[model samples]
Target: MGTSLQHHGAETSPPPVCRFAPSTTGPAHLGTLAAALLCWLDARSRGARLLLRLEDLDPDRCRPEHARSLLDDFTWLGLDWDEILAQRTLAAQHEAALDHLEARGALYPCDATREALRAIGRRAPDGGFAYDNRSRERPLPPGGWRACHEPIRVALPAGTFRPFDEGGLDLAQEPALAFGDPVVRRRDGAIAYQLAVVVDDAASGVTRIVRGRDIAPSTATQAALQTLLGLPAPVYRHHLLLLEARGGKLAKTHLAPRGAALGLSAPRLCGQLAACVGLLPAPEDCTPTDLLRTFDWQRVTTIDRVVRWQDGQLDATPADP
Candidate 1:
């Protein structure tokens, strides 16, 4: 029998390729800026290439003005990227991936409407209504998922798939229960975030994923999709989220005020965001470049940040332990 041994003189791994993909559904808010800053710092600190991907696949919400505004916001924050991609422009690739999943029997048309699912669904761990996977009981149409106009969902394998995170975030979950077979394509012909993100990251060779911890729950599902497609799984680090003091996340749906509208300069905004994640002692003026050399994941706080928007300014503190 051959013995397994570590190779001492193996070639070094390539530099990580990181990306910040923000949906173009709304203007960039404090949460958006903070997420982008963390991703930028993680990539730049390692001298890795970072990509700016505008997730404009959702036609119902994504707007051209929002995309342009986001590009400008990142530039103002001094976060540079090696390449820029718009997800909507990659429809062909997304379609090809769907085709692959369909041929593998990993996809099925989900005719269940949101109202229907919510009627008989239980609350999932992620707080959304868990899909019953009732569609799996029905046979595919004559031509399969493509022939049906219903939303397409990926049928994740039945097992507890866990993906490791460098920051020690637990991402072990049965995706079929946690996410309940996420949609890959909506009835409106829009590619869903889960499928598009998996395809885009693999195609772009994304090796490091750094985003808010709010997205940690989705990691297992994405990992499952990666395995189904025979793609490599990247190292992940889901950081702290900036939430409002009232016990809700700072989100676009809440109409969270934009950072620019607060009248804070780029340096001040960067410092504030850094402080929220334990990168700074307090909200002071600094640039992303200023923290590049000293950036270390060890300093980042795993706790969520409770922030308040008062008097047209932002203040942040750690959530109660």
Candidate 2:
């Protein structure tokens, strides 16, 4: 593994290499599309490389056709990526990372099943397990899974601190409090997202990352992972989330229609997205080039956008056209 990158300052590069990794669990949703566009703009403006990585870690949820459609949609928007990589392709490296962490005494065997853990009330209010450390003292059970969350080792600000995003969203207290001991690998023997991302980013030399702010809380925990693994932490810019009318934010799992289903040309689609994001002077039709002419980070909205994403278009305003 490469040495941890000094990503705290601007002197680290001409511009950090950014990436927009979309999961292929289903078709690309509006929120993911917006992220892809924004990340592309960030890299393009900086003359830096923008990578497209498919986060198809789940065999059951992610489909090959979903990935194909993801590429097709991005291409339709005229969004270009330098290199395309798949997370599943690097399974060996991810597993190696898990082993390395274990060798370094970072992981502890976890054999408790869902029923067993829940019996002890380990499930938290958020639907995720609070993961009481009762199993920590137990011997390594046969065919047990492994994890590591000890020493916390993460150090952030005392009170309020900007975790990510343009709005300066503050973590309640210490950022590390947001995450517990994370599962490095699943019982089914699959590498987890945290370890895989840190390891892959280090290998790819990805210095910058732009994604939705929904996962912003993980930054601190992942930072600790990078520190422990002796890998570089990339600069992160988590943008405001695009939410649905109710329920939850638009995601690939929402079963939203593909971008081609909108029936708009690439330039028109780009123009509409730019207008919705406060990038255009007006909501009139325009192209990616036109949006680029006036693109400025200062102009981006700092709050969440409730875009009524539909089959035809995105309604950013409550008043219907």
Candidate 3:
């Protein structure tokens, strides 16, 4: 048995393929820039190839101009990538993945409405919410399609994640207990983030993942999907999120200031972003190329920082938590 394991060791996935997947629901902001910088440096530091992926699968929110603006924003920052791709363009692959999962009985079409499901599940401990599944034989409600988790769970390694900074983490998770049944597809005939991401990461050869900790909870569901699809689990580096002192998390939904509004040169913006993640000695102006000289993963921290707009200026102050 041990001999067989050794034989397959050589089959471990190919060389590290890192990615910076920016959602196109809005323009890239300071926090987005910071996360992208870390992901870029980590890939470069390892001499690994980094790909730029526009996660614009959501039809309702993603717009054509936003994609153009994002591409322009990255070009201004001096961030380079081996290739650029978009999630929407890969619908065939996503559908294939879904077909595979469906055949394996790993996924089933859900017909419950959001309101119906909400009536059943309970909340989670993280101040976030989760759905508890009892998705048996329910009729497909009109304009109500929900993807449900059927008492399924995927296991994870246990530890902290500082994506792309320190080495990746090994954290454990029970999918069935925590995530319950989640919607992989929406009633609008659009694919969900969970399914699309796992499929895209595997297809793009992404052996490592670097993103903000705000979505850390997504690891388990993605992990479960990977397991179901028989795909390799990429190493993860979940970094700290840029937060607002009062509102919390500097999310795209907030329509935070973009690169244009920051009023700084591309190089200077890179330096500021690098400093936010402990990649530099201070948060002064610098270029992605300049900070590449000072990149060190050990210096990265996982604590969330407060980013607020006050006195007509943007600032980041460490939160007591």
Best by TM-score: 1
| TM-score, one value per model | 0.92, 0.80, 0.82
Clashing pairs in 1: none
Instruction: Please report the TM-score between candidate 1 and the true structure.
Output: 0.92
In lDDT terms, how accurate is model 2?
0.67
Per-model C-alpha lDDT, please? 0.84, 0.67, 0.69
Scored by lDDT, model 3 comes in at 0.69
Give Cα distance to truth, residue 78, candidate 1, Å: 1.2
- Writing each residue's lDDT as its tens digit, candidate 3 over 21-139 gives 99898877768777888888889888888999998878889987888888887778888899999888888878787667655545545455557646755665345455555553343
Q: Kindly indicate the candidate among 1 and 3 with the higher TM-score.
A: 1
Model 1, residue 216: displacement in angstroms?
Answer: 0.9
Off by over 4 Å in 2: 1-14, 111-129, 139-167, 171-177, 253-261, 309-313, 317-321
Off by over 4 Å in 1: 1-10, 253-260, 311-313
Question: How much is the lDDT of residue 185 in candidate 1?
Answer: 88
Candidate 1 lDDT over residue span 139-240, tens digit each: 567987678788888888889988989888789999887768899989988888889999999888998888888788889999989988888999998888
